[model samples]
Target: MSEGLSTRILDHIVHLSPPGTLEDSADAFRKLGFTVTPGGTHADGQTANALIIFADGTYLELLHFTHAPPASTAHPWAHKPPGWIDYAFLGNAGTPSVADTINRRAAADGSGVRYAPEVRGGRTRADDGRVLEWLITAPAPSEGNGTRASARGRLPFFCGDVTPREWRVPLEPRSNAEHASKARGVAYVKLLVLPSELDAYAKELTSVLGVSPAASSASQVVWELERQPSDSQPYQAPTLVLNAAEEYEEEIYVRERGAGIYELGVAVEDAGKAGVAYTPYGRVVWQAIGSR
Candidate 1:
């Protein structure tokens, strides 16, 4: 795994839509005031995406498959519905990959959070026709009597760039990082869990990230993931909030999406801009960061 707390840093969260709705999804985000950058097709050619890049080097990937009944049944997104399907952690390009380190830790603690071998994945940028590649280390299916399967949607996978990181996530032109909504970067991602599953999920997350909760209560757990400070922008540590479903809407969301991300929090400049905004598939909450 990565050194120290680097393993816990948030990379990006994925927002998926129904098939053939890539442009519609981008349009929807644009209407919500985010600057949507057109992304290219995946190596498999079955998926395409658009990105909302933040100055903090994190982003929201809006993706959809080219075919409704994706040509391959084994496709990860084939059966997933449109919403906050998954999230990823920034992987390290060093000895002992994220998968190996996490698997070793899990084996030692019996947390059973095994990760599959890193797989090469990339996409051709629709904007400039450049191919960007990365190594993905995702959760492995449960083994024998292991409960590794329980960590699927709840835990994050890893993404290590093979190509230059800037090539995959461009932040030049200044305007690319400027959102009309005044949203700066990800503030936190909230995951709603069934009350009974809260503890189990929290433990799995701890195992995967090699970090303990920053704060915790009987009903909720929080991890404040630190990001590399930007030279021109103020530093903001993104968070992961895991709470038991309590509200009527939250209950329904957990029922439908299971124990996965359902809400996104964005950091904005003005308090007046702080509020909730609904996208076609997910909910975003605007939070004022006060001064700077």
Candidate 2:
């Protein structure tokens, strides 16, 4: 494996809800000016999802199970709560794969960030019969010891497409990406963690993403994605922010749901025009493009 892994782009964020709430979740996002496309059931036949694709190749997945899986199933969603439960980063196609590098670096750093071996994952489009396939590297299962486990839901997994990327993300009739709210793409994803766990989680994330923390403080730590500066293009890749939950005014989700995704920052042409609304899942913050 290379001393350091190649940069991994943000692929998508997963928003999980209870069964039979898929349509309502789509409707809620549609009301917020996103174009929600119909997603089909997972290959496991346990869950279904709807996708909100952005122009930047990043997307938001609204997932819910068609019916609960058997009690013996060990999928992550089987016991997760209703909210932004997980997220994934794009991975390379060859060996020592991105997952390998992540686990390797985590082991070297002693950050306790490890993932299960890559596995095949796929789904058939509900609108059409087309099939989509990919390889996923999920967090390794916990050993019931006091040691921190990646399966607790703080770290992101990796996804590498077996089929062409464009096939999974179609680009046709620009209208598919357009929205009523003038929203463009994801700006950043904010995660909440207890102040005590901030340093450990930051180290774990740094090792997993193969990126260094840009800024850190008692309140929060920020990791900005690496992107070349350009005069022609102003929008940069999305960022990942880990905030201390105790600093917040209201209830911190981490208190209820462990360390996990808390808020989604979306980029819009005009924040004023993009009205703020709370969904059954979580909060969405609309910000003007290029704003910090």
Q: Report model 2's TM-score to 2 decimal places.
A: 0.90
User: Tens digits of per-residue lDDT for model 1 on 47-133?
Assistant: 899999998788999999888763557766577778888998888554467888888878887786788888889999998899998
| TM-score leader | 1
Q: What alpha-carbon RMSD in Å does predicted model 1 have with respect to the real structure? A: 2.4
Name the runs in model 2 displaced over 4 angstroms: 1-7, 144-152, 226-233, 247-252, 274-276
What local lDDT does model 1 show for residue 124? 96
Q: What is the C-alpha lDDT of each candidate?
A: 0.83, 0.77
Off by over 4 Å in 1: 1-5, 70-72, 143-151, 229-232
Candidate 2, residue 266: CA error in Å?
Answer: 0.4
> How many steric overlaps are in each model, in order?
0, 0
Q: Write the per-residue lDDT of candidate 2 for residues 1-292, one digit (tens) a residue.
A: 3754454467788998888789989998898778987778889888999888776667788999887666787677777888788988776454667767778888889998777788888888898878889888777865657763446457887777887765566544467667787777778888888888889989988887777888888888999864211112257678899988875542356777888888888888875755455778788888788677
Residue pair clashes in candidate 2: none
